[model samples]
Each structure stands twice: as C-alpha cells, then as structure tokens.
Target: MTDLTTAFERVELPLETPFTISRGTQHTAANVVVRIEDGEHVGVGAAAPSRHYGETAATVEAVLPELLDVVEEAGDPLALDRIDARIDGRIGDNPAAKAAVRIACCDLAAKRLDVPLYRLFGLDGERTVTSSFTVGIDDPERMGEKTRTAVDAGYTVLKTKLGTDDDEARLAAVREAAPDARIRVDANEAWTPREAVDNCEWLASYDVEFCEQPVPAEDPDGLRYVYERSAVPIAADESCVTLADLPRIADACDVANVKLMKCGGPRQAVEMFHAARAHGLETMLGCMIETNAAIAAAAHLAPLLDYADLDGSLLLDSDPYEGVPMPTGLVDCSALDRPGTGARRA
Candidate 1:
C-alpha cells in the first residue's frame, strides 16, 4: 500500500437550456468533484446527484470527507476491492458520494497502469455504441425544435421526456421532426399503470424504441402491470438502482438502466450488467446532468451497455474537463489518446 491524498469541491454547471422531466425542471446542475492523488498521478471523478434518488450536491459534499478518509486510510489507489468494501461499510447510502470516490480510485489506478480505462477492463475499444441525446420536456413545438436540433447535431438516437397531459402531441412533434431517429420515452414514474399501458400503445405507434420508468418505483406490481400489457418495451431506471434490484425488476421490465451514481461505481455497474444479463434483461447506462469529469468515466462502459444515454456533459453549456469524444453521439472509446478515463482539464 502507498500513501494517498484526497480532496473535493463543488461545481455548478449551467445547462445549455432548462431541462425538464415528469418530475420537474432545472437550469443548472450541481456536481461535486473528487480527486485522489498518489504522489505523481491524480485521479478525477465527480458526483452528479439526483433529488429523485434522495441526493443533492449538498448531501454529496457533506458525506465526501468521510468517504475520502476511507480512501486515505486504505492508502492504495490500486486496492480497489478493499477500498470499495470499506467505502460501503462507511456509508450504506449516499451512493453518489461513494461513486465519486470509486471513480477517482479507478481513474488513478488506470493512470498508474498507464492504460485507458476500457483497456484496463479488458474491453474491446472497437466495440462501441452511440449515446442517445435527450430532449427534455418542453412544449410540442419546442420539443420538435429540440429533436431537429439534436438530429442536425448528428445524434442518431433521442430520448424524450413525456408523462404530460399532451404526451402524444409532444411525441408526434418530435417524430415529425426526426422521422429516422430512434426515439425513446421516459415517463419518470409519472404515470399510473393503466395510463402507462395506454401511453405505451401510442408510443409504439410513434415507433418508440422503449418506455422508461413508466410507473412509480415504489409500486413494483404497477411496473409489472404496465410491462405485461404495454406495446413497447419497458426500461427500469428508478426501479433498478442496485444489483439487488435486478432480481426484483427482472420480470417487470425488459431493460435495466444502470447509473454509476446509483450503483456506487464502475465495478458495481459491471456487476449489475452481468446480473441483468443473468436475469435475461438488456443493460443500459444513463447519467444525470453532469460534467465531463464524471460522464467521461461512464463513457468507457459503453461497450458493456446495450443502450447508452450518456449525453449528460453534452447538455452543459461548458465543461471544464474533456473525457471521451462522442462525435455525432458515437462513443469512440478507441479515439481516446490518453489514459485514465480520458478526463483532462479542457
């Protein structure tokens, strides 16, 4: 084991536009960035918290000192297994905080090994997936405009926010704007089972690829009800937070949407992906509105994902860091020229 040093800071990132979902809206994202250093190398990570998951930037900031203490005590950036276990032991919740520490450790470890994060995981950098750019909830015309803008930006897939009274209108506008784009919808647990079932029927008519979190996570049966009756495939975001959720949500939804913040870290996300496959579920990776400091690390996991919604940093008005390059929404991990998750000061 070697000596390790750690620190954290909070950064507020403004979005290019106000982002809205079934839950609410925000014009800025609050992220807490973590750094772990081992004499020569600094590993970077950030926590993008969600109110829906009971975390905010304040919560992440409050818990990080204790989490960083765990890393310092472990004293070895490469000792991920020990550090990860100790972190979980320190805080059973506060997943975003834990994730920040985990991501930093991985980044530092990869830097020490002098390899790209994907190469460290023995993944094929050539095997890639295009991330879906999101169009947050807006008026029908605005939604159409956003869809057209994303398509013009070369995003081949788009996920739009729905669950409004005028969901059909919103979707129709988006489809009309990007007829060839693969469209997906996320209701964000805003609909009841019956409403979700009815919505999915029309969602399929609009050629939606899937419907995400149609019913509340609190009501597992309601999710299953919608899944069993819906015309489109169902993806569980709120319902599938950790590996334990895989078994419970396996029969209820077809896709398991894993977020690094929700799962605690990259390792945990890998576990969830394999577990999801075991349960006959497709795997997807989603992100909160975040900085490239965070989203860059998640990009390395693209090969493991059946679908990637990692456009978090792309939504930012500006990012202080640059990670992997996603030209036209294609996550080109192989194009990463440097190691350590490809995150560097921009």
Candidate 2:
C-alpha cells in the first residue's frame, strides 16, 4: 500500500489579468496547494476561498496545519476516505479549504494509479464542456468594450457582475456590444428580494439566460418570489451551499449553482449534483478565484450538468502549475484523459 501523507504549499501567481468585482479586489491570486503523496504516487488539489463566500486566505492558511495532521494520521490507502469522513464537521463551515485538500488527495491517488480523475467518477474521457467568461463591475462603456473583446475572442457565453448603481446601464452596454453572445448576471447576494425581482425583470429586456443569487442567501422566500416574478431563470449560488440547502433553494430557484469550495469537495459535489437532479433542478458548476487545479476539479463535474461557470482561472494573470489549459470560455478536457488531475506542481 502507498504510504500517503499530506503536505501544504502556498503559491502566489499573478493573474494573466486581474478580475475586479463589487465584493473587493484580487491582484495576483494566492492559494494553498495540497499534495497527497503515497510513496511514488501523488495527488494535487488547489483552492481559493473568497470573502464573498465567507472565506479568506488567512483562514485557509490557518486551516492547513490541522489538515496536514489529518492526512498524516489517515495514511495513503485510506487518506481520501478519512478526509471525506471528517470534512464537513471538522472544517467548520469553510468548505473551500477542505475541498482543496480533497482535490489534492484525489489527484495524487489517480496519478498513482495512472488514470484520470474523471475516470474515477465513472465518466468517459470524450466529453467536451463550455465555460462562461465573467465581466466584473465597471463603467458601462468599459463593460461593453470588454464584452465585445471577449465575444470576438470566441467566448460564446458571458457572465456579468452586478450590485451597484450602474448595473442597468452595464447590462445594456454589454448587450449592445455583444449582441449575439449568451448573457447571464450574478448579484452575489447584493439585492434584496424586491430588488432581485425588479432587476431580473429589467434584465429580461436583454434576454439574459439566467440571473444568479439575485437576493441574499438566507432569504429563500424572497428568492422564491424573484423566481416566480422574473422573466428569466434564477440560479441559486450563495443560497445553496449544501444538500440541506437544496430543498429550500429548489422551491425558489430554477437552477442550482455548485462550487466545489462551497460544496466541500468533488465527492460531495457529485452527491449534491445527484440531489439537485433528483429535485429536478437545472445545475451549473461554479468556481471561486483559483488555479487550474480547482478549476480542473470543477470542470470534471461540468459534463454531468447543464451550465458551467468555471472560468475563475482565466481571470488570473498567471497560473503557477500546468494542469488543464483553459481556452477562454471553454475547457480543453483533452488533458483530463491522463492520470490524476494532469496538474504538475511547479
């Protein structure tokens, strides 16, 4: 049996570009990369938790010591099993950190076995997934100009950030700029129930695909109201963090947005996907600001869902490790055919 042990390393890579939003700012991305090594085999996972989801670099950093101990004690053969068992309760409410460790272990395990991570989930290697490029909060003209650039770059889908005074104009500008591109909007829980419903209705003029997290997470009733009133579909982001949140969220949401960080790990994400499907909810795979490792893990789940928002890595100026190469709004899953996550630590 491989003697698996977990190790943590911090990486700081500049964004090939910077992504700005209403929440705050991110320059060079910082993430903690977890490595699970069992003798000759190694698995890698990377995670970056955002403040919008109630996670920060300092918190992820502080949690690593405890995670290392958990991996060391669990050993290689049972490393993932043990990690899965304690992930939810021990990690408190921060799913992002636990997800990072889980991904690393899976990557290491698959690498050891000389197989791809998706194959472990019983998925074939021939699936292609399309991703969405995000347009952060900015001036309407600038937002429109960015949208035009992205569209010209061959991004078929665009996700625009809203939560400020200029949201209406921004949406209009982007629509005018990228007339043929599929558009979606995410409010990041910035709107109230009424505001969400009202804004979503206004957005209908542009024919948006859906509106995500229109209202605050805790306001399920408000979400339901927005869903019923809005012309476009409503996808729940902050509102649906766990399986438990699904039932309540499903009542109000037309779709569920699943983020590996918010869902805990790949295993839990799969579980949630199953539950969301069972509830007859359309599903979207979302991501936080992360490296290719986390983005790759999330991409594995995209083939199993209807919508994907795993473009977080593209917003970064530089990716430290080479795993899955992101081509704008689509994922080149050709790399996923290899063993592990196809990520090589730098």
Candidate 3:
C-alpha cells in the first residue's frame, strides 16, 4: 500500500456574472480543493460547499484535517466502499467534504492503477452528455442575450434559471434568442405547487425539456402535486440530495438531478444514478457553481447520465485549476485521458 499524504486548499472562483437562484445570488464560488499524493503520482479533487446543505469552504477546511487523519490511519483508498463507509459513519452529513476526500483518494488509486478515472468505475469512455450552460436569473433581454451568446459558443442545450414573476418573459426572450437550442428550466424551489403548474403549462409553449425543483425542497408532496397537474416534466434537484432521499423523491418527479457534492463523490454518484433508475426516475448529473477540479471528477461518470449541467467551470471568470476540455459544449471523456480525474493547478 502506498503511504498517502493529503492536503487541502480553499479557493475562491469568481463567476463571470452573478448567479441567482430562488434562495440568493452568488458572485464567487467558495470551494475547497484536496490533494493526495504518494511520492510519484498526484491526485487532485475539489468540493463545492453549498449553503443549502449548510456547508461552507470554512466548514470543509475545518472538518478535513480531522477526517483525513482517520483515513490516513485506518482507511484503504483502493477499497472505495470502505472509504465511503469511514467518512459516512464518522463524518455525518458533510457530503461536500467527504466528496473531496473520496475524489482525491479515487484519483490517486486510478493513477496508481494506470487507468483513466472512468475506467476505474467500469464506465464507457465513449458515452457522455453535452453540458448545459446555466443562464442565471435576469431580465428578459439580458437572459436572452446570454442564451444567444451560449448558443453561439457551441452550446446546443441551455438551462435557464426561472423563479420570479417575469419567468414567462424570460423564457420567451430565450426562446426568441436561441430558437433551436434544447432548453431546460430550474426554478430552485421558488414556487407554490399551483404556481409551478401554471408556470409549467405556460413553459410548455417554450418547449422546455424539464423543470427542476419547482417547489421548496421541504415539500415533495408539492412536487407531486405539480407533477400531477403539469405537462412539463418535473426534475428534483434540491428535493433529491442523496440516496436516502431518492425513494421519496423518485416518486415525486420525472427526474433526479444528482450532484456529486450531495451524493459524496463519483462512486456514490454512480450508486445514485442506478438507484434513481431502479426507482424508474431519470437522472441528470448536476453541479454547484464549481471549478474545473470538481467538474472533471464528476465528468468521469458521464456515461451514466441522462443529462448534465456541468457548465459550472464554464461560468468561472478564471479558474485556478483546469481539468478536461469541452470542445463542443459537451464533456468529452477522451479529453480527460491524461491521468486520474484530469484536474491540475492552472
């Protein structure tokens, strides 16, 4: 077994524009990066600390040293389930921090095993999803402009934020700007069930592929209510945090948007995808406004995704780390073949 040394850093990734959801707006993504090394090979991973999950960059940093200490002594990085068990049993609900550690460890193991991270999970490198660039909540004109720009930038799919009173106008504007683009909408749990049904019916005119988190995270019954009345497919984001939440959410929505930060890491994410499928719900690999390090780690599992909203790194003004490349607005796992999770300090 290789003697592993682990370390972490807090990174501030400034977004190109402020990202707004129903809960709030974010100008910068406060994330944490973890690195695990064994003499010759280096593995890197990152975490997006979500406020909705009650996690912060500070909390990840504070929790990591203690957590990593346990892993160093008693855990086996190569036995992923053991690693996850160790973290889960000891660490409790800090999914983001546990995700970073799991990512770094798996990255290191993959490098040692001399295979790409995808191969480690028995995933096909050829299968992948085109990532949808998110256009945060904005005025109709501004959102339309952003949609046009993303379309011109080679993005065929556009996911727009819509929660406020002007959602109809915003969707209309985007529809006008990128008439041919596959559009998806995320409400971030801002509407009442009745309001969501009304919006979903109105949104059908825009050809929206799906509506995410249309009601508050706390109310799956409300999502079910929306599901019963709306023509547009409802996808659960905040409503589906981890595998534990799936049984309930699986019945409430058409799809489950699984984020690695919420699920723990790529390994657990794979589990969530299958579990979602087993429960007859589709899956989308979602992300917080994150950096390349985290996004690349998640991309390794792209073959299993029905949809992807991995434009997190694409939203950054300048990312300190670079991992993988999306030449055609879709994650090309071939681009991430270098080693490990393909994340490196830029």
Candidate 4:
C-alpha cells in the first residue's frame, strides 16, 4: 500500500498575456498547487478563484491551510470522497479553491494507481476537446482586431463578451472579422428579458451559435421569456450552479454551463451534467480564469458535453501545468487517451 501525504504549494505564474473583461482584470494567476505524494508516485491538482465568482487570491490562500488537515485526515483510497462529504458547505470557500484540492487529490491517487485521471473516473482521456477563446468587451474596432487575431491563431470557435453598450456593433464586427468561425456570446447576466430577446435576434442574423445568461440568474421568468423569444439557443451560466437549479431552468435554457468551482468539484459537476441531461438540457463545461490544473480536471468531462467553453487557460499568458493542450475552437476530443488527465509537471 502507498503511504500518501498531502501538501500545498503556492505558485504565481505571469500570463503570457493579459485578458480583460467588464467585471475586472487578470494579469497573472496566483494558484495553489496541491500535491498528493504516496511513496513512489505523486498526483497533482490546482485551484484558483475569479473576482467575478466572488473569489480572490487572498481567499484561496486563506482556505488552503484548512484543506491541509482535511487531506491528511483522509489519507486512504476513499480519502477524497470522505473529505468532500465532510467539507460540504462547511468551508465557505470559493468552489474553485475547493475544486483544486479535490483535483490534486484525485490526480495523485490516479498516478499512484498508474491510471489517468479520466480512466479513474471511468473515462477515456484520449479524446480531442476544442475550447473557445473568449473575446472580452472592447470597442468594436478592438473586438474585431481581437477576433481576427484569434481566428488567425487557429481558434475555430469564438465567444464574445456582450451585455454592455453597442452590443449590436460588437457582434457585427466580430462576425465580419471571423465569418467562418463558430461564434457565441455571453452577457454574464447583463441583459433584460426583452433586451435579451432583441439582442438574440440581432445576433442570430450574424450566425451566432448561442447566448449565455442573457439575464441575471435569479430571473427564471426572464430566462423563460428570452428563451421563448430568442432566435438562437439559450445557455444557462450563472443560473445553473447545482443540481437543484437544473430542473427550474429546463424550460428556459437549452444548455447548462458546468464549472468545477461552481459545482464544487468534478464529481459534483458530473452529477450536474447527468441531471441537466435528464432535464433535456445540453451540457457545457466552462472555466473561470483558472490554470491548467483546473482546466485539466474539467477537460476530462469534455467528451460528454454538447458544447464547451474551457478557454480560461488560453486567456492566461502562461499555464503552469502541462497536460493536453486545449484545441482551438469546438474541440473534437478523439485524441485524449492518456492516464490521469494526461497532466505532467510543467
């Protein structure tokens, strides 16, 4: 039997570039890398928080020390499961931070068993997953320039940040710049029920694939109104966080965006996906401004989703871990066959 110990390390990685949006700014990612060392093998996991999701570097830093005890206490085959159950709603910590700890423990366990993360979860990681590169809210000219740059860089799917002024112009400019690429938009809960319908109609004219969270998450009536009125598909982001919220959103959304942080961890996310599917909603795996560690864990579920927006790592200037590279645009996950999410030390 492997003798495992849990340890945490802080890492600050400068973005190869900076990604800005309406909510705030992110220049570098300060992540807590969790390592599960069991005698000869080691498994790693990472986690970070986003300001939009009400998380900060300081919050993650504060919570990680508490996790150290949880990990040490549950040092067995079912350690992660036990730890997850014990910490449920008890941590008051950001979902992303907790997810990182869960992922690291899982990764370490898989490595010790000589299996890939996906395989441990009964999945095949040798699948190709395309992730969308997000283009944040900028002037039409800048949006167009960013669109062109992403398209030129081989991104086949593009998601534009909407919900501010001149949304129509922004949509038009992006469509003109990347006419052949798959396009989607996220309002981040910025649109009104009527405005969401109107804008969806306008965006549909430009061949947009869908629009995410057209209204605030609390407005299921507004979501239903927009869903019935809009020309394009509606995807629920902030509105669908847990399994309990899935059924309430069924009529209002055609898809549910799943994030590890929001759902607590991959295990919960997978459960949410199944629940969403049962409600006739498609699943979309998404990410906050996280590193490859979080992205890697989420990537394991890509093959099961109808759409994905896991481009959080690409927005980073540099990702600290090495796993499978996120393919540009609508990933075709037919190539991920490695063990334990294919994550390697970077």
Query: Which candidate gets the maximum lDDT versus the true structure?
Result: 1
- lDDT digits (tens) for residues 220-306 of candidate 1: 999999989999999999999999999999999999999999999988999999999999999999999989888888999988989
Q: Give candidate 1's TM-score.
A: 0.99
Over 1-346, each residue of candidate 3 has an lDDT whose tens digit, in order, gives 5577889899888888888876788899988988877788877888899878989998999899977876676545686777677777787888899888888888888888888899888889989789888889888989888988988888899998988878899889999999999999999889999999988988998999999999998887899999988989999999898889899987689999999999888888988999999999998998988888888888888899899888888888998878777875678887665878888878
Alpha-carbon lDDT, every model: 0.93, 0.80, 0.86, 0.78
Q: Per-candidate TM vs. native?
A: 0.99, 0.93, 0.97, 0.92
Flag regions of model 2 displaced more than 4 Å. Answer: 16-18, 77-79, 334-337
Q: What does candidate 2's lDDT look like per residue over 20-76, in tens digits?
A: 666666677778888777777777888787676778778888887787667766676
Off by over 4 Å in 4: 16-18, 89-93, 124-128, 329-338
Model 2's number of clashes is 15
Worst 10 residues of 4 by lDDT: 327-336
Cα misplacement distance, residue 234 of candidate 1 (Å):
0.5
Q: Please give the TM-score that candidate 2 achieves against the real structure.
A: 0.93
lDDT of 4 by residue, 1-346 (tens): 3366877777787765566555555678777777777676666777776666787667877787777567766666346668787666458647877887788777777766777666677765455557788898888998899999999999988899987778889888999999998898999898889888888878888998999999998789999999998899999989987778898999998999988878778888988989998988888998876677777878778767878888777777777676655555544334545556566666
Candidates, ranked, lDDT:
1, 3, 2, 4
Best by TM-score: 1
